[model samples]
Target: MALTSVAVVLPGRPTLFELGVVHEVFGIDRTDDGVPLIDFRLCAERPGVPVEISHGITVTPPYGLDAARGADLVVAPAYEYSDTPSEAVLEVFRQAHADGAWLLSVCSGAFALGEAGLLDGRCSTTHWRHSDELKRRFPRTRVDPGVLFVEDDRILTSAGTAAGIDACLHHVRCELGAAIATRIARRMVVPPQRDGGQRQFIDMPVPEIAGETLQPVLEWMREHLVEEQPVRVLASRAAMSERTFARRFAAETGTTPAKWLLAQRIHHARTLLEGTDLPVETVADRAGFGSAALLRHHFGARVGVAPGEYRRTFRSNERRAG
Candidate 1:
């Protein structure tokens, strides 16, 4: 699938931030950058009617839920948690799932998916504050308050606020390609990928550090992905002892240097696989994996597919044929 169409179900009092995230990622026109144009539709229960959102803010969408006939992706942003979503909203969710449209929820929007029985036997999440409530409401769904977002089968449920961006960009990267996702992310001025989970947000405080940020070192690490990145060398580069550097790195990235480097390598490998016709061995070497077998093992473990298969499905020149 080329991801040509995206329909967002704007329930009453939808949060401006989550709604804006979907619009900004898929609705905004970026064709000049060679990004694919998506058909972004705002379908609501009350179409062409003023729906109050935010604090006395009103957004009147043009299309009703019935109008979203062929959406490739269907999104639900944070809805009022106290109200069980209307039958109309739930119907749209069920239909989209039956149609195999990619379903995503931002923040408390996971409640709607749960009501639609979409989250039954699926892993889902909401805001950490609401994670227990979600689990209580939909006991069959595993509510993980730890991760930023999760993708099981086709449903993607994200934690509060900014985590929605991670989920959307992740879908773009998986379905479109690294190039397209990177383009959208760059325009938004956010990281193309963030390594941390949402546990940092739930009662976790930032530890005071005496040294400067490791941003420069991180930049250097990405640029030198093909080269060896021993933690000792990285620690030395950061002008800190290994112990202090390790602590700072964990606080900043929520992962160790080795795991981060592995992820970067896999990401770089994916980019290479999609954009070029390089042999797998060459790509592995270029991405710092050193050999095709090593690349296959780690890539399959992380991506759930062989490199060749992923390339065939999402080659930069074309889109996946859904």
Candidate 2:
């Protein structure tokens, strides 16, 4: 692949760590060692203005939003918690999307993308803390707080800070080979990839009182996902009436219990698909999906690839590594 230009957009009071992730991955010159280099620039709505950062640093971008108009990729690093994106900035994103440039959001940057209306009817994600607010603010976006990143065609959204690195490297791997992406990860001294998706963050903090009561049941479901347990059985185990359990589960988990379970099952199936030599039938059975056809249906819907295709890709990656 040829060197591509990447435009990074910064909101006022951007999260410094997330911005650094983008800079390290795309901004720095790494072509000396045969790596595919990305021409990167930081852009703001205006040039020559120093934007405040979270840790009291003022970053003055050399270019403005117009710089993103022709870039191959546009990255929006995290904004501050309270920063509502402006319509003009949103237009920059919209225009770029119209031009077929790939748009990516990191952490609270997802919030900005949502405000820009770029994420409408898209599967996107953000920091777990802000995922609810993002969903509430932009009802059109299907906010899946449980995934590290969601790749919806040209738009890619990653969960908070470090997940930005994962998302970026994942893109590199997708465009370049896994060898190139892993080489970059080795140079950066970060894990090439983290096992499991952001679904692991689902249990981070138990809600208070009304929502708190379902934590135990949620944890149980995660632990016993392979079991052939029905929703009524799960509700019975939680010691709540099925109707109450259904309502409370949605309130606390941000999704229905069945959907959550299916997501977990699919996630597990993906892990097996990527990391193991198991057949599709065995993978589906182990993940509680019962049949390869069922695995194909849900896995294609969630991961956007069939289990066999995913396994073949991973096997190709392993061959490259070897």
Candidate 3:
């Protein structure tokens, strides 16, 4: 269904960062780019009353829980985990899901959905720090702490702060089109999609980049994505030993050479699917997957959809616009 309206349910002591992320994705108007305007509403349990936020500031939502009754998408931003959400808020979630509206939660917001029983028997996730508690409290919900986000049965849950951006963009890409999603990402100055997962943040150390050491090599890699990039070849290009190059690459990119290359190939394949009518085999060959079967395998794993299905969804949107 097209996303025409969005309602954000703000619980007490809402985390400012997560609330900002939701507003940035849905509240901003970009009609000049042919993007559809979403009627975004921020609703609270008590309208016209100021609620304290995490950063010592207060916000007064203009609408109440009743405003979220029939929104196409309902968002729950992160709130204080110790506080129990009111039945009114939980009822909105239950009703939204029953009405077939897309439900999204960021960080501790997943707990509200869990309390409402909306996440029962569905795959979901939350911030890694609270994953165990969520699993213990809602045993019926499959909580994956490693992924940045998970979309199962129209319910979306994101792991932590920035991961919320990834989940929101993924929803836009699926519901609107990749072109519209990409335009939003450009305006926000963030990547359309992020690679790897929340696992990168579990215990990783800060990377140290001294100077313009890896810029040229990274640029070269992007230009030659379709070619074989063995560790030795890349090492030679960077004027370093294979072992040092591999170590430094992981330090800088937060992923191994093979994994990063595969992600880039998949991203290129998605662009081809959205913008061109190229055959799957041809797209696979051009994106360095070498064959249609290999492309479908990786594309399905990363995108949660087959290449042809993705093409049909985005190309149909293109036709409608034209």
TM-score of each: 0.94, 0.65, 0.89
The per-model lDDT (C-alpha) reads 0.86, 0.77, 0.85
lDDT (C-alpha) at residue 191 in model 2: 57
Best by TM-score: 1
Candidate 3 C-alpha lDDT tens digits along 1-322: 6788999998557998899999999999999877788899999988999889855688889999999989989998999978889888899999988899999999999998999998999999998889999999999999998877888888999988988998898888777777788899999998776663524366556445454567588778778887999989988988888887877787666577888788879878988899888999999999999999999999999888999998988787666544
What would the per-residue lDDT of candidate 1 be over residues 33-109, giving only the tens digit for each residue?
88888889998877889888867888888998977767988998887878788888889989988988899999999
List pairs with backbone clashes in candidate 2.
Answer: none
Q: Which stretches of candidate 3 lie over 4 Å from their true place?
A: 196-198, 207-219, 235-254, 318-322
Query: Arrange candidates by TM-score, highest first: which order?
Result: 1, 3, 2
lDDT of 2 at 14: 82
